[model samples]
Target: MSKKLNMSRRDFLRLTGMSSIAAGVYTIPGVGGVLAQDEREVTIFFWDGPPLIGIREKALAPFDDAYPGCKLNFTSVPGGPASGYNDKLFTSLAAGIPPDVFIIEIGLLPQFLADDLLLDLKPYVDADDYDLSQFPDLAIEAYTHEGGIYGMPDNVASIAIFYNADLFEEAGAMMPTAQWDDPEWTVDDFFSSCEKLTKRDGNRTTQYACDVTGWDKVWQTWVRIFGGQLVDDPFYPTECTLNEAGAVEGLQFYADLRWEHGFAPRPEAMAMGTTALLQTGQLAMFYSGSWAFPNFREVDFNVALGHYPAGPGGRANYVYYYPLVVPKTTEAPECAWNLLKFFNGPAMETIIREGGLQGTSFAEQEKWFVTDPLPPANKHVMLDAARHFVAPDPVLTNFGEITQIMQAQIDLLMIGEERDAKVVCDEIVRQVNPLIKEGQWRSG
Candidate 1:
């Protein structure tokens, strides 16, 4: 006979606590607890800067106007250098004092979701009378885990090619086009163009062909172009494909521009101001995420945008979706939901456009695109890049750790220490698979 299965009181309370939290209702004091006063205020904690500040403020405006005494208290957390934000956010959660709504970057979203720190906003989102289709399915899907919705997206970011038009003209090369997938005009064309665009001193001192400087960022682009991935699958921790033959080929291609072709600056030399290199008319091409648009525009040079050069796989690219998620410790679930919906609505168009963020909503993007025309290179280049970009699958947990592992091994390959790609792949799997297995997964 099978014995009756019963849960301990502590287990039951834990389950109940999770259920309440997932439902966006929690019992706490002052924070997510019941409001004693007649007028209620929602406290939101998030990063400070032009990109987020603009989005949060515009979204909360209509809510304040509609609800009268319902005010939004915006708290500014330390921003920049990533580590500061991560440490502070973790400390708050550990102290059981998380904000009602917070911004979650793609790289770190998995950590919070796995720990059940985020609320499932499905019910609120389902009841809202808004056009969810305006946003990409990829953006919505990124925040989802184990069949439940944990967050709503604020930005759909992709790595695109930003070139200096005046620099390109100086090199006497034509701008890249949508048919970058065509072998005749893609890989070889891109590097050859960079070679021509590269400038050198009379003493052969130094200058720039392309400012594709960052190690991990450039590797991600090349890995996809060769049809390889950092990990085999998001949910399963089986094997790593980083050292795959294809991936190695991709890395070599990147390294060749620096080592063999003598086009790019040496690693140590690029340590100085990179953007300044572009502004001074020393660099021709810079590949990076659309988030850098604002930073790049600050330069005195004329800028133009284009899609990342495609490979044999056809129009390969990478994107990141930053989500706006409500935490389980939220004091006002209803108010947070109301403000979140408004943030993703029409009002957001103005905020995102002015802030120079490429968000998840096409309508909002189009609004920004119309007003802030792409500088000379290609006005519609952003839309073109969006067409083929692929973000990392969200099923992977502790994404920050995984990238760190991949990057460490990738550095070996980048520096010619690991000539065989398969060897690198094998070592990565041995190092990270156990960590993935030991991780606690929430009901996806």
Candidate 2:
């Protein structure tokens, strides 16, 4: 990325008549003016930012052409909820001028649904008698709440272990299988590999075996694999279940990976983030979702997806599934739905398949995702994961707030600061239960 030197549009246009663009189109590259202009412009916002404007523009071109009169006025907001995007969305909602359609992460779905901010897409689905069976069961269930459809599975990904094959070979550690049900790949095997793969330099580690950043996603996966859940119930949760023994055991295993076993790096020790550590052969294995595919695709080392080691719950993998949603406040409901329907089609799949997003819920697109001559000779792990994936993060009405409270405690546990997993888990419950009591999900 290069530093931006601000210049007015007038100055830019004056400097050059037109710079060449993709595939010989040499015009000022903007969005949503491919076809004739129309009055019913369906305004939309996505959090992908300006870097992906070209892809978004190309993906929505067919939609614009299909309904020339109902133009899709699109804007790319750079950040997810943490950045200015959701803040702008909430502000727009308050002003009664929210976009016709927008993007949101799965964690915020319950909040949006409980607040009655999403349109009941069931009417559109029923009217078309849409064969929603094509999507993965996880998606169909997650997007539908209280017998009403709110969104369609847009970008999807599942958690799995991505290991550096070369590092594993050099360490003489056993390579993990891609098969989901392989009894050989267990947590014990993973610990052995981490031991062998780690290297030391005079009490200062040179190469770390793995990383558990104690982020929201990583710890949550451990909680799920131990046959535990974060809440009593997803939609109507009254208490935090992380205080249970199963949850504590799961979290202790994660904490011990760094603090006790010395197999993984602590957050402060990692001068360069975990991804960089993996790319440079300092970190042997990375635990993350397919969303990391784009970053890892270009690395010099050979990357492969390992079958997640079996835990007490037997190889449970958590997926972070974000969907494209249409707001109930849209001026043109029909046009918004039309735009959303187009997003679920093939063009969008093509856009996401190039190391973009995996576990997209398309059974037929299996070959497209794995057929690439990439390092992961065993990419089918994704297909198996889709069938058996779990969404462990409790979807409460105040999910974002609850997550902040939970993460604060879990981070200490991940590091050496909090040795007792039960102490951290208990603190999470004590702080987060009140919020859940007031804002647990309710049927709209």
Best by lDDT: 2
Error of 2 at 104 (Å): 1.9
Local lDDT at 83 for model 2: 78
Best by TM-score: 2
Return the TM-score for each candidate structure: 0.82, 0.86
- Put down candidate 1 lDDT per residue, 1-444, tens digits, no spaces: 999979999999999999988556434447343444544577666675756655656555667876655567776665642747657766777888777777767767777776778888888877875566676666676677777788777666766677788777777876666343445547767877877887677848355777545457567677677776666665444556566766667766776676666677666666666656666776676676566666665666778777766675455666666788888767678888876776677557666666566766777777666567545345455654554456455355665677677778766655656655566667776787775654436442
Show the lowest summed lDDT stretch of 10 residues, model 1: 31-40
Please give the CA lDDT of all the candidate structures: 0.66, 0.75
lDDT tens digits by residue: candidate 2, 220-328: 7777777778888765577888899878888998899888888899888776878788888889987766556667767888888876678886777766668778888
Candidate 2 has an lDDT of 0.75
Off by over 4 Å in 1: 1-28, 31-38, 50-55, 81-83, 178-185, 200-207, 235-237, 294-301, 374-379, 415-426, 439-444
Q: lDDT score, residue 186, model 1?
A: 70
Q: For residue 314, what is the lDDT in candidate 1?
A: 53
Please identify model 2 stretches exceeding 4 Å from their true place.
Answer: 1-39, 353-355
Which ten-residue region of model 2 has the weakest summed lDDT?
Answer: 26-35
